[model samples]
Target chain A: MEIIELINVKREFKILNRREGIAGGIKDLFSRDYRYLSAVDDISLKIKKGEIVGYLGPNGAGKSTTIKMMTGILEPTSGKVLVNGKEPYRNRIENAQDIGVVFGQRSQLWWSLPLKESFKVLKEIYQVSDKDYKDMLDLYMSLIDIKNLWDKPVRQMSLGQRTLSDILAAFLHNPSVVYLDEPTIGLDVSMKSKIQEFIKGLNSQKATTIILTTHDMGDVDALCNRIVIIDKGKKLYDDNIENLHKMFGMYRIMKICFSKDVGELDYDSLKDKAAELEKELQENFSGDDMTVSVDEGWIDILMNEEDVSLMEVMNFIQSKQHIYNIKLEEISTEKVIKKIYEGGTIL
Target chain B: MKKRNVKFYLAIYFKIISQDIKSKLSYRVDFIISTMGILFTNIAGFITFWIIFKNFDNINDWNYYEILFLYGFSLMALTPTQCLFDNNWNLRDYVYSGDFIKYCFRPIDLYFYYISEIFDLKGIGEFMMGVGIIVYAWINLKYSVTILGILALIVMWIAASLVMAGIMNIAAATCFWMNNSGYVMVTVFKFTEYTKYPIDIFNKGFRIFFSFIIPIAFVTYYPSMVVLNSHNLPILTIIAPIFSVLFFYISYRIWMFGASRYNGTGT
Candidate 1:
């Protein structure tokens, strides 16, 4: 059975032009103008149980509007949203019981309380039994490496600590479906990896159906099997990860760092190497001085972000470089998301 | 179906409370400072009256003890509500950040979770001061000492406070749409301030509005009126409980409605 199903869901909002400033204050008092904005326009999607889907879009792409409708937090102006074969908005309680959500930029934990306290409170809300609670807690604490930090106040804890606590709060109930919005935003490399590991563990181990909307492409690369792309209140594409990469035509960004200090590589030198690497991989890579540079004894490489085959570029770089470690990464999920949004043809 | 009733909700409420307390205690200094800050505020209010009464005999025939009694009842009547709903003030922040998703996702009512998070231990100071004032006023009023009256006062006072808290819950819940209409809460609170004292001092219509429509009268005025045995306002004791239940249900529904209308863009 499908864990989530949305058929032609649409959301429209009324625009209020009454600006905040006092300059047009007198004219605004009597006149009330309403404009229509289709925040989520005729979007349809479906996901089966335990599939980790990367719901991607640039800012203001109606990705959030769609999620809000599916969660029953916002009523769709038209169309049906079904999770576990029930209308989410009409039957909120039942829908809610099966879902867990995490907003990356916000802390769900009480700022004044310890991490454990938030967990205990959630325990009662979800009404988990002793055994289930212990099992879920053990699993999360292990994956997230949450130790004594649980005892510390959430406010006093670092950004990493608060995020871990927030993640734990979302999954304590062992819900069947989970929604994560920018779960890795504003996180360091280590913290991002830890969160990704926990999410991956949940999806693989428990077969938890997951929907993640993020600007971070690494999150998609590390965990998701499918990607749903939306832009300007519309769904442009929805399919497997391979399909999104194929349709969007994204490329790897190879950044190589030298062990010893070296002279700056001018735009010509950098472009020459980039083109050479491009031909070697048989993929088109083009950039100017601004896109590619060498500064502070480190080599920075920006390839055609549209190309997906990083392994080819990896082999090419290995054959060429004497020895500094090289880091090759794709353009951010947000950037590929931007290309998909702007109606740019995939290269 | 019957198994999932009030007991189910009460259990969840207490669990959330325990969790909130645990979270609050994590930052030892923040907790102590916030709790202590309430006393300073109360002292400021106390000192204003002290200076004013020091010069004049009384304000419009009310002495310090009488005024103190009013303050005590109000503070006490307001304390429990604040403890329970202080987090309601955060509803605006919650609305913007869409953090209220935590409550909506739970099978239990979001009302309890949102209100419970409104924990503000600052009320402890108000609670203690209120108790002291009530005692002083009771002694000074010098009515015949009876155990039953004291018991009734405590019981009815709690009922009144719950009603007050329920109203705040509704105002706080409105944050779902106004996203920042949280300012409305402060406006409502400021509006409540006018009714905190005896409305009898005001004109006929204003007093009528506070007593009947808004029901700020029941919070301190009615219970104290019962204790003092003043006027012919009949059987308010019975109406108190009925009103509490009615308001709690209405405000709760309004919250659900607002939440439904919530975009949860931060969701």
Candidate 2:
């Protein structure tokens, strides 16, 4: 069954478009000029139980707005939002009881209270049974690696520790569904992986439906099997992770360390070589889909695997110059998002 | 299962308050200083009133002790309201900082969650000082204590606290419509200063405005008149509960209206 559903949900906010400065500010008090901004425009989605779905979007792309509606924090301007078979905004308390949400930028825990006290308070607030609470705590302790940090005041804990505790608190009630908005944001490598592992555990072990919103593609790669990408308040792509990789993850990066310094090469000489390489690759590979640059003592090459094979590019590079070492890496999400932002679409 | 038991909510509220107190008391020196500051300020205010009455026998027909009754009753009402609902006074800060979202998704009522977690320990000093002043004034007046009078005072005090809390809620709710409501709250709190004196001292326009429009008079003046066995209008005290309930309902309605507009903007 779908634990969360939004049918044509649209949220419009009336933002006062006031001018700047003292006189403008005074005039704004009586201006009555409001520009309507659609934070979420006709977004319809259904998230199933136990499915870890990544909700991806750029800044101000209505990602948090949709999460707010799902969490019953904001009522939709039009259409319906249902969580567990009830209108979330109308049945807010009931919806809240069955779901947990973590805003990575905000701490819901009491600022001065110990982490354990926050867990205790949330346990009562969600009315989790004693046995369930104890069992969940044990599981969380084993999974998240924050057991020793439990008694420390939340204000004293590091950002990563606080975020881990928040994740624990959100899952304490064994909620049927959870929304984690950038839970791994600003976390170190090890901490980020730990959180991702914990989120995976929650989904696999308890079958808790998880909706994750993050810019960290590592998070999407690690935990989410399906992803929904939105930009400018509209859905751009919604597909399985494997399919996303297969379609848009076509670029491959190659770095070659020369036997000698290449940085001493004149700009004109490098530019001429780059243009010649581009002409050869375009003629040989059937398209101009590669870029070459010299950095330090190494030459870096970025190529679309679809346009030119890695072996072909390597052979060409070897023929042109003496190679010391070579390494190839898949294009990063940073590159993919930049590509998408530049109007690239899944083929 | 949809609706939580009121007892469950009450238990959580107490736990929240106890946790707040525990956190507050951790800064022992700061807590002591804050409490002492409130006590000394109230004491200085009491001395000022005492000196004014020492130079003059009475202001109009009200004696020094009688006016003290009004002063003490106002503090008595104001302290508890401030203690339990102190966060309401800083609602604009909450909204501006986007911390108000913390209250929105809870399984408990948002207003209940907000009011329960905030307990101002400084108000304890005001409460103690007010009780002491009321005891001292009663002793000097030789006022006879009766069960009926005690009941009336208790009921009136609760009603007065409700009125203040409701007014604060209304003021806070304005943050939903406009940002930076510090001015609105300051203005409203300044209006409450007039409740410290007998309404009879004010002109007819001010008295009528206090009685009908803002109704600050009911919070202390009219309620204290009944408790002190003096009545400019006993019917005002008799109808205080009705006004209190009416104001509370209106404020609550206004809060709900404003809360629906809370978009967690700038979050």
Candidate 3:
């Protein structure tokens, strides 16, 4: 069931060391000086069939490079890369038949061709049987409803329409594995959700494995069951989404509503009181990250659930003030990713 | 290894061409102007040739009509190569923009997909002009036409086109390492202009260079020499087909090497 495997892969790119100015340009033409950049360094991963894996990383973190190697567009400089038990770059044409890829920034569709023409061309390239092609079209049309845009040239279509069409083309042949790099990038919220839904639909119907690379955390939350976080060409975290939440996703915001009205509480005195309460709470929950700020009638507290339980946090708050209401909010995945980038270790 | 079905590749090629033409024709004025511009350029080139040959009796024992035949043959060979595989000439852009990545994901042969994906229809005017000049030169020279002669001409034309394609492929492959090789293609294409005249007029070094190093002479000059019954080595001209096959294979190997490097390094 393991459809894709990358074993200790490393890819290095030679950077021509060029200086500025016309004279330098001339000298560079004759210069043999160059430096090598390791883009994907010593990474190993295995992706199983029908599993949606979120290949999450910041820019320049080697997400696309790994996808390229998996899709056979790139060969690792060292180690082994196998898709469906065949070395991808060594058997590219054979590997390509079972894989599909879409770069959100680049369209695989012909610029001047009608959407349908691109589909037909792909049909020939993959040798998709007519019945299967028709069935795919029917299924995709029902999911994304691109039938009306069939005759329109890809150039004239909006970004959402074009990306939708691209996704359809990628899955047209029922590829066993699909690599989607930022497929929802540059689309409106509604369009992004629609694409996410379509992708989910395809995976369920065909049991297709998907490796989605995206900056959108919502996409990762919605689609990916497992997440692989890479930073600077190294795998920092690889676990299911719930575990990521348990590890780095424990920050919570506590908003306390005081029984007293705004006029009754002196702003300066309340601010002083809130600062004193924060210092006391910090000592008790020593390793937990916490902060408190007071408004006219209420105090807002932010702390990590890993160090202090919700009951403990509320007990401290209730001892300080008579609360009329309380609001507890878990940290967003976006903030969790931000914290990961800031060097938060996996639990 | 399972080979791709030829019909499937042909279908992709025709589809790409049709789409390319549609894209070009969408801008009606631009397409017309570009086609007309090429036609005018060819006409002007012929006029310059007429002016030069008017005063000279012959250049290195070849008359004006014979030179016309040479130029016409070069055009016939060059146009098809440039037209069918025009996108290969834009490999610099493809590399810079990373559009080449799309070609890599396909099941088809990379070089085959690269060449077949774009059809420059502006070459139609160039082809028509070439045919007109060739017929005029043939009539004026009164070269006797036989079935074998016609067959030989067709084969020579095919070989010449292959030579041009091979050269273009090599130049495009350089972009894999160089990142920008438009100048390489332009320089090689300009060098082919030397084949439109008698090699004897050029210096001994130039002749040797064109004959062996770059082999532009084999494209039209040598083939024309055999066709005109002026071959110094008549038997050698028969090697054009063999030379073309070798050239194409070597160029393909070079392209594969470059592609592997590209994938390995991603530059």
Candidate 4:
């Protein structure tokens, strides 16, 4: 059974307009100027119990807006969100018990207070059993390695440390689902990895369903098996993250290096080599993200980054004449997003 | 949440308050300076009154000490309000920063989490200064240590303080929408000055407005009227604490309502 469900979840916001000047300001006090904005436009998706799904989108693409609706922060304009068979907005206080959300920019733990104080407050708010509270704390301490920082004030902690505390505070109630929106934003690389590990730990150990919304591709790569991309309030793609690489990011970059400066290649000869390669592929190879350049003691060849794996690229380049150190790398997720942003379709 | 006992809630609040007190004391200069500053505010109020009384002869038949009682009573009535509900000062910041999200996702009532966790020891200074002035005024009023009068004062003052705290929080909770925040307690202290005077000075219309429309009288006027024993204490005075409890529930409801609407923007 699905632990979470959303049927045509939608959200509209009233955009207020103001004419500049004192007169307009006074008039605004008497009457508000507003236009309707459909932030989340008729979105519907479902996650079965214990699934970790990535909610991906560009900035202002209604990603957070959708999460807010599902988490009961914002009520949908035209649809329903059900978590554990309860309407998120109508039964918010009850719905809150079932899910933990850590908004990356907001500190869930009290800033002035120590980390433990915020955890204590959560205990009262959740009414968690004593045994359960201790067990969860123990698990978080292992996951994030923040035992020493427990008594330290939140204001004094580093971004990574604070995020660790926020994550702990969110999950202290042993909630069935966790909603982490950009949970690792602004953290150092080490901290980001730590947060990702802790989240995956919770998902596997507790069978906790997770809806992660983030722009960090590393976070998505590390934690999310399923990716849902939205642009302009519409779902563009929802598929396996690995499959995304196969469908749109299968290209690899192969660079060949020569031991010594290959004496100036004849421009005519290089153009001829390019023409010959184009003909060899019978129109399969094109210079889109592919090009060869000659510089400082080496001739570099860049080609169609495809099914030719990095290992294959290296083996193929190694077998070629006069090649020195050869390098092959898979395209990172950032480039994949660039392709998607430019309206590239994935199979 | 419904089944959770209030005692459990109180225990958590007390724990947070104790933690706050210990943390506050760590900054000793701040602790001493704030207490001194709060005391100075009342001292300023007294000097202002002395200056005015010298000029006016009397304010509607009330003397120096009489006015002092009004001022002291108002100050004391407002002390707990500031001490308890002053934490609501962060309501606007809370909303903008989406800290209320932290409060709402908890299994317990979010309302208790905000009001209970933070304390102002400086208000303790404010509360003590009022106690000092009230003692001086009581002696000047020719009120001996009459057990009945003191007991009535204590009982009425408790109800009055709670009511003031309620009004302060509910007003502050308006930040859920306005988010344009000012000092939660001091900014709207209409009664803190007027509470010392006898309700008689205000016209009947204003008296009704203060008594019910805004309930400012619950803070000082009605309670002092009891201690002075000027007239039979109305049954309505006894009902003030009931209103205090009601205000608390209503304030919590408003706070929780605001808590739900908060969208933590930064995620």
For model 3, how does the per-residue alpha-carbon lDDT over A132-237 read when each residue is reduced to its tens digit? 9999988887777776789988889999998988888899999999988888889999999998999999999999999998889989999999989987788888
User: Which docking class does model 3 fall in?
Assistant: acceptable
CA deviation > 4 Å runs, candidate 1: A17-32, A141-144, A246-338, A344-347, B1-4, B19-37, B47-67, B97-103, B170-184, B191-196, B230-238, B265-267
What CAPRI grade goes to candidate 1? Answer: medium
TM-score, each model? 0.81, 0.89, 0.86, 0.83
Order of models, best TM-score first: 2, 3, 4, 1
Which digits, one per residue and each the tens of the lDDT, describe model 1 over residues B10-119?
Answer: 77667666666665676689878987888888778878867877997766676667766777888888898778777777778867865656566666566665676656
Candidate 3: residue pairs that collide: none
Poorest 10 consecutive residues of model 1 chain A by lDDT? A283-292
lDDT of 1 by residue, A64-164 (tens): 78887788777889998888888887877777777888878777666666777777766766677889999997887667668878787777888877777
lDDT of each: 0.73, 0.82, 0.82, 0.74
Which residue segments of model 2 deviate by more than 4 Å? A16-35, A256-301, A307-325, A344-347, B230-233
Quote the positional error of residue B58 for candidate 1 in Å: 6.7
TM-score of 4: 0.83
Worst 10 residues of 1 chain B by lDDT: B229-238
TM-score between model 2 and native: 0.89
Kept native contacts, fraction for each prediction: 0.72, 0.68, 0.68, 0.48
Residue-level lDDT of model 4, residues A1-347, one tens digit each, is 88888888778888678778999888887777688888887777888888889888788888878877777767888988888888887866678888898878777666667788867866876788899998987777666678778789888888778877888877888888898888889988887887788889988888888889888889988998898888777777788877887764556645455444445555566556545533543343444554444434334444445533445444544555556556656656755675676663533
Point out where model 4 deviates above 4 Å: A17-34, A141-144, A253-327, A344-347, B54-57, B97-99, B144-147, B179-187, B202-209, B212-214, B234-239, B246-267
